[model samples]
Target chain A: MRVLLVEDEVRLADNLAAALRDGPGFAVDCAADGLSGDNLAGNRCYDLIILDLMLPRLDGLSLLRRLRARGDSTPVLILTAKEGKQAIIQLLNSGADDYLAKPFDLGELIARSKALIRRGKGQSHPVLSALGLEVNTLEQTVRRNGVLVDLSPTEYRILEYLIHHPRRVFSKRDLLEHLYDYNWEHHSNVIEAHVSNLRKKLDAAVPGAEPVIETLRGRGYRMAVGPEHTIEPG
Target chain B: MNQVKRSRSIAFHLIAAVLAVELLSSLLVGILSYGYERHIHFHAFDSILHGRVDSVIGAVQDAGDVDDNVMLDTADLHVPKDDIYEVFNSRGELLGRSPNWTGTSAPPAIPPHRHATFSEIKVNGREYRLLTQQGSRIVDPGDPGGGKLRHVTVIYGAPTERLWRAIHAAVQFYAAGSILLLAVTGPLIAWLLHRGLAPLRQLATLASRVSADSWHFSPPASARTTPELAPLTTAMENVLQRLERSFTQQRTFVSDAAHELKTAVAVVKSSLQLLGLRPRTQAEYQAGLERTLADTQRLEELVAKMLTLARVEDTGAAPGLPATVDLVQSMQQAAAELETVAKLHKIKVTMESPADEPVMVALTQEDCSLLLSNLLLNALQHSPPESTVELRTALQKERNTAEFSVRDHGEGIDPADLPRVFDRFYRSDPSRTRSTGGAGLGLAICKAVAERAGGSIALASQPGQGTTVTVQLPLTPNPDAASQLA
Candidate 1:
């Protein structure tokens, strides 16, 4: 999964980004000011946006308002130091999916970020299962027929993104934007290599199991949909 | 508990004064009217007595005797029943007398030149007014060319009891009128005064409602227009507005302080939490520990700055310290103390003074150092590498102030951020300043220190040229004495 972070405090942003990247294996992109954050959010397709209220150039509320005005429905998780119920309610009313006050536990932030990303794709549970393959979003692990499956962080993220949107076909560009942040150099073939590796792991996990991932010649990739691979609710 | 004595209301005092003056004037009027009435009554009584005596003389018509003497005619005399009279001829022979005449003192003989004489007498234990007069009668008007003069004396006396009673009645009427006037007007005056002072009472009620939470002060139109209350109403509005502004400033400062402290703690907490997320090699763990230590150090710095700001703000009056501090010396020491920081930033810190004489200010040594250090540090932080930060001091003799300033040739503050540069926890560029471990309390502390010493601090900056922060402190009146004591 991919996420964007907008915070004025450099150290706090760095720490949070590191936590999200290591814990949830999310491709994290950071913006230090509200103006840049707005620009990045407007142009990029992020599954989740972590916003800090007190930002330079423009405040977080105005950015959120502008984003919502343009009909960008990316799930927003607000980080605030303001200790008041009124401020929290205002943030939520301003198109924020959730909020966490500052000095919050790092573990809680990661958990909530993953949950919001999952819910943003119309899933409610932390684990996504399809074609006898179970992807635990919280633990960043995958299992085939109740057995552990070893996968690279990149492969795990691609599988997680594909599983969240079960039957949607994602082109190479879509996969690149969804699975990688700005820090990564995007080459069309990079998505191909990661997808190929992810498919190999899934097939190798259970030799007789049906294919969990499907590829169309021109339409790119989608999760395999058949009688054998039934998509669970979450 | 000590009970405060409630003073009399203004209306009460005013009404009492008016009533007192009215009572005194009424009494004066009563006395004056009584005296005037008595004079008129006495004049009328005298006229009646003259008329009665003349009638007695007329009745002394020719007795037809050969001597041509006048005799009293009791039938022709007409007077009050309580009156008495005595008649006599020129030879001093008594002709006739009133039956009530029983006094031992005889009436005085009328003077030859005087026509009448009047006096007050007490006869038979009764007060009487007596009139003695000389008169003449024409005994033979047809024989002589005019008339024959027959001289006679008549004494008439009337009791004065009725006159005294009439005068008393007039005085009583005046006294009763005065009492009635006082009774009617006393309450009228009090009610009028109370009504007239309504604006004052309304102003008091409105002023009493002012508090810390609510600064609403809308004086009634009556109070605003009243000549006596306009000034007070305006003064109260001005005071309340000033207090509200100060309260808002304090509230903003407190919230900003809380935000900064919380953010700092968050940075430290996240760093430690990130380090504990997974097992790592010894080298990776060592690097993570160092980074976490740095984050904690920044947190410690933020807490220390906040404390310094609080301490500087809480300083009231003049603390017990050296009476005077030399601005030139303080500047030099501050520049030297920040030498390492200046070196690290590749900036040169220089000091300039117009005179060799010490510019002594009335500030404590610690406060002087604090003000100088904060200004120098801020200047150095904003200055570019290999640039110069100038520290200047001068004694402004005309204004009686000691001026110290720091000038840096760096990227100056934007016009928008200039006004709030000294506000607590307000940073011009949050991301840039946060990386440098600036909590934005340095300039705030400098301002507090300057104001606590009866001084003022100001900033002037250009976007590209540079920025200069100046502090002016009141000069000590007896600098030499203070230095000697030190």
Candidate 2:
């Protein structure tokens, strides 16, 4: 998945962006001030935005308010220094999806970011399932009938986005838009390659398993509904 | 304590002055009224005595004979029981007297054509007011002088006991009236004073309610205040506003400190977690461990600076530490200690002191060293290579203070950033300070130390020219410079 981080502190922002990129398989773009962050957020299509409350040129709260006023509903997770209860209440009221105070655990931050992205895509549960295959968002791993299935980071992004809205057909352009930030020059064939790899992994992981991703004619991909399945607890 | 209390009680003093003035003036009025009433009573009694004496002369018409017989007629007159009368011829021979005249001699009779002579005399062991008069009958109407004149002297004496009794009763009434006037007005004055001071009492209540937990104090605008207390309310409000501002500033400082510390710890924690994520080659492991070690060192440095700042603030809060420090000696020691750093940076450290006597100040030796070393180290960090950093000490006897200054011939701070130089963790250029490994707390520590020593610190800088830091500490018990504590 694509992510955007807006923070003023140079070292903290760098380390956090690096961790997310190397560990969580995300295309992370960072902005040092609220002005640039606001500009980038308006122009880019990212799955999530991590915002710091204290920023130069404009504050995080004002930027958040403006983004929501302009009807941008990308999941927002705020990074705030301990500014007391009143500021926290104001931030939550101003369209922030979640918040993590500074000096927070890196594992917890990554977990919350994935959960927000899931919830933003109309998936209320932490784990999504299709035909006995499970996408555990909290553990950031997949399980097929009690067996581990490893996939490339890009393949995982496309699969997770598709699983959030099961059975919803997304064209090549639509998947490209959610899979890349504003700086990327995406090609539809590139997404085809990732999808092919993800299909091979899913089929090889469980023998005789039904294919979860189904391609429609003149359309893109969908998490196939071969049999009616209910969401199971992970 | 009583003397202090007496000085503070304005209400009591006001009432006391009013009572004294009221009582003294009332007493004078009472005395004046009594004197005037006595005059009126005596005049009326004297007039009555003269009138009675005049009628006595009329009663005498050369009784028995025209030559020697002188009688005051008592048959046709009803004499007062407390009064008596006597008559005498012009030759001073006793002629006729009233039956109540028991004294051997009457008051000397008056000559003809003379007004009544009133006198006080003791007669029969009783006090009497006597009036003497002279009158002639018709036997002297046809004569020119004394040839055919038959003149008689008449004296009338009236007891004054009854007149004094009435005057005494009126005097007592006047005294009682004065006391009654005070009784009616005393409490009314007290109530008025109390009502007038209600605003002051309300202000006291409002001040008492102010604490760290509660800052809401609403002064009563509708409460009445006199001109004297109006300023008091305004001054109190100003003080409360200042107090609130300080509290807010302190809160912001604590929150900022917490944020800095949290960020430091976060950097270290995230770096270690990421390094331990996967197995690596021996060289890569060494590199990762070294990187983690560096992060921990920075973290430790930040924590140490925070602790130093906290300790300085705490010391400033409680100033009971007794100490004696020589400003010049401390400056010399600090300059010597920075010799290695100066040599490494190719900067020359210079020390200057003109006085021979020790400049004793009220700060401990360790604190004085900390203050001087911080200033000198800051100067060294800012000074360019081959530049001179000067540390000097001087006695400012005229100002009753000892001065210590560290000046550097280096690029100075911008005018915009000069005002916030002493704020904790504030840096003019964050990237530059990071490269220099300066924690941005040197100037703040110096300022705190100076203030705790009953002194002040000031920085004067010209952009692109140089910078000078001057710390002036008041001397302890200077014999010739006693304005140190002022």
Candidate 3:
């Protein structure tokens, strides 16, 4: 995947490029400031574009706006030194895919980047195929044996995040970052509430396999894959 | 420019000038009186000498002289006037003396030209003037020893005491008149000048009372009673009216700014409520709702900070709230509240050992908390996760200042950017994105709170090396001093 990086600070930009180069199947190009970043974004097609909000020429918000206005559907991830929540929300409202604050963990940054690409590719929708279980992204519908299942939006998001990373365990915080779109004040109960809802909806759709979405006790949730999945009573 | 307001009135100056003229004229009158009295004494002595000499020339036939010697009774030759006369034949000899001339100094010889000569001589511890004349008079103009007879020189001596006595009386009378003149005219001259200056005085009182809050400098209709003060009054009224307009303009600006901010805050709050009212799908909420909440929060913080800035700007707190507070205890309490946040970020905040005795400071409690909270919170917020933030307080004996400092080992600020950190809403990193949650008003408020407490706040930093923020306050008063304590 080819990614475009927009940052005003040369050193930080260079560092991010070096980090992104290590990501699997990724090629990264950098724009030193907002003007060139806007110009390049206007004319180019890419898998993903990384943006910095405090840019020298044109700010990230306006650039994001112009990109969206031109009907470009490329995923844009905002990276900024400012940690104020207001600015983050502004960027997200203007159509940024995801955001990472400065001095963030490199592993988290990479995970977020991959997640954004997966979302752009529509790969995050859960495709529960066995035992008549099915999840649809376009219609946002879940059905087992042609019967639709009702789930809240938060529950659907949790189910989708698990199904996307099949067999990989997710902590509550990871689910928060992946399921919800921006950083939020963390409350562990929010994950529990959504997880409970997702379990009820999935159980109503396909009654036998309770192990499909299993909680790893102190760890978190994971999507059971292959043949080892089994029904476990709550 | 307000000289009329500061100086004494023109009336007072005019009165002082007039009194000076009267005093000078009176002094001249006293000196001239003495000169006239001295002239009277000299003329009286000259006539007495001529009368005595004529009597002697007329009595020459009664002497029946035979050998150039005439014998005659000289008692009848004396003149009755209060003058002393002596006869000499071209020689320095005294032939006759008056009763009052017993101890008087004789006169010098007369000049040969029949003219009297006046001389000043001291007699009986006082000064006197003497006159002498020489004439071969034809006895009494009626008879004579012919036209030219034996020439007899006469010297007249007179006491200057009587002359001084008359001069002294005149000086006394003149001095008395001068005193009366100054006493009666001083206040009268002052009153006349004051009457002329009354219009200006009214103008001054009117102008002095004009202020920014009220510019009602309506000079009385009668203020132009004197034409001299009319132009001045008009000029002052013009200036005052202009100032009144400018002040009204400033007040309007402040009120408008306050109203706009209030409206913005209300709109943001309503918008947030609207976004939260509906049950949102996760994607829908993430797409828009969160951003709205963040913006609302930013608006709220901005409004609150602006209000605080306005409050701190408007009123000087009367120093009535002074109370002894233990700064160490205050910092410890504030640090306790911040500890939970600190632990989440893995940062350890610890208070350094305070002085041997509690560092008691005199300040309002609210101001103290505000001052310390801003410094400590800023340090924790700016530092890297897991970094240690230290709070220290000490009293400098010589400087009489109690100091509190917070040090953070984070990504330090650049030197050029440190000074601007205290300006309201001025963020060095302009984005003010969600992660920091700062409106950049914290430090500015801290500075105001510290100053209101009669203290000061300053920042010291080296880029990449940490930053230290310090506050200094005056120590509490000595409780042992009763006067100071009261």
Query: Any idea what lDDT model 1 has?
Result: 0.87
Tell me how each candidate scores on DockQ against the true complex.
Answer: 0.79, 0.45, 0.01
Stretches > 4 Å off in candidate 3: A1-234, B1-15, B18-26, B33-298, B307-315, B319-321, B433-437, B478-486
lDDT of 1 by residue, A68-94 (tens): 989999999999889888888888898
TM-score of each: 0.87, 0.76, 0.42
B211-284, model 2: which lDDT tens digit per residue? 87687877776332466666776777788788888888788777767766777677777776666655668887
Docking class of 2: acceptable
Docking class of 1: medium
Model 1, B1-486: lDDT tens digits are 133237776788899999999999998999898999899999998888888887777677678788665677788667777888887777766778888886425546776688888888887788999898887777777875775777777888899999999999999999999999999999999889889998888888888898887889899999999988899889889988999999989988887877788888999899889989998889988998898899899989988888888888986644765478788888888988999999999998888896668888877777789889989988998999999999999878999998899999999999999999999888999889889889888999999888887899999999999999999998888768656634
Clashing pairs in 1: none
- Which candidate would rank higher by lDDT, 2 or 3? 2
